[model samples]
Target: MAQSNKYQTGDQVKVRVDSPSHHYRTPTYIQGKTGVVVAICGRYRNPESLGHGGDGMPEQLLYRVSFAQNSVWDRYRGPSGDKILVDIYEHWLDPVGV
Candidate 1:
């Protein structure tokens, strides 16, 4: 049987700063940013492994996180409520304290 999702919708989480010296899917700009899990995109084969021609296995949970533009950028000059949604994996997330 498949495992249940570790996070739920509306869960506050922080993206971990895992700067592996290899092909990665998470964008550098979103690293260390805090956001809310808006949706769970299910699981899929690990892409980082497939990037280097390895057989992608052990699928991971993907989540749609929404982050306020201002919260993500220190010098953000856009709309106050503008947000960016990103698809992130389970391993890249850290639960934020209430």
Candidate 2:
């Protein structure tokens, strides 16, 4: 069965700022940061569960999220248009207005 994606390209989303004791792939630097969905990278097995020696059932939808450089870093000295793209799982993201 195919999983339905919660977000689409151009959707605004915020990364969840969670610090779980278990293994996770979401980077801490991008946590709690807001970004726009640039692409849907399809579904894949959950890495966190795999890392813990559990069967990675229930794949997760992955999305390419884009964030403004200045928004991600307080002292970013790059152009105002500069942006960073991060591959984030659906579980780590929340819709900006919902």
Question: lDDT of all predictions, in order shown?
Answer: 0.92, 0.94
Per-residue CA lDDT of model 1 for 1-98, tens digit only, reads 67999899999999999889878888999999999999999898888888888887788899999999999998999998999999999989999995
True-vs-predicted CA distance for residue 23, candidate 1, Å: 1.0
Total colliding residue pairs, candidate 1: 0
RMSD per prediction, one decimal?
1.2, 0.8
Choose the strongest candidate by lDDT. 2
What is the RMSD, in Å, between candidate 1 and the native fold over all Cα? 1.2
What stretches of model 2 exceed 4 Å from their correct place?
none
Candidate 2 per-residue lDDT over residues 4-42, each given as its tens digit? 789999999999999899999889999999999999998
For model 2, the run of ten residues with the poorest summed lDDT: 1-10
- Model 1 TM-score, all chains together: 0.92
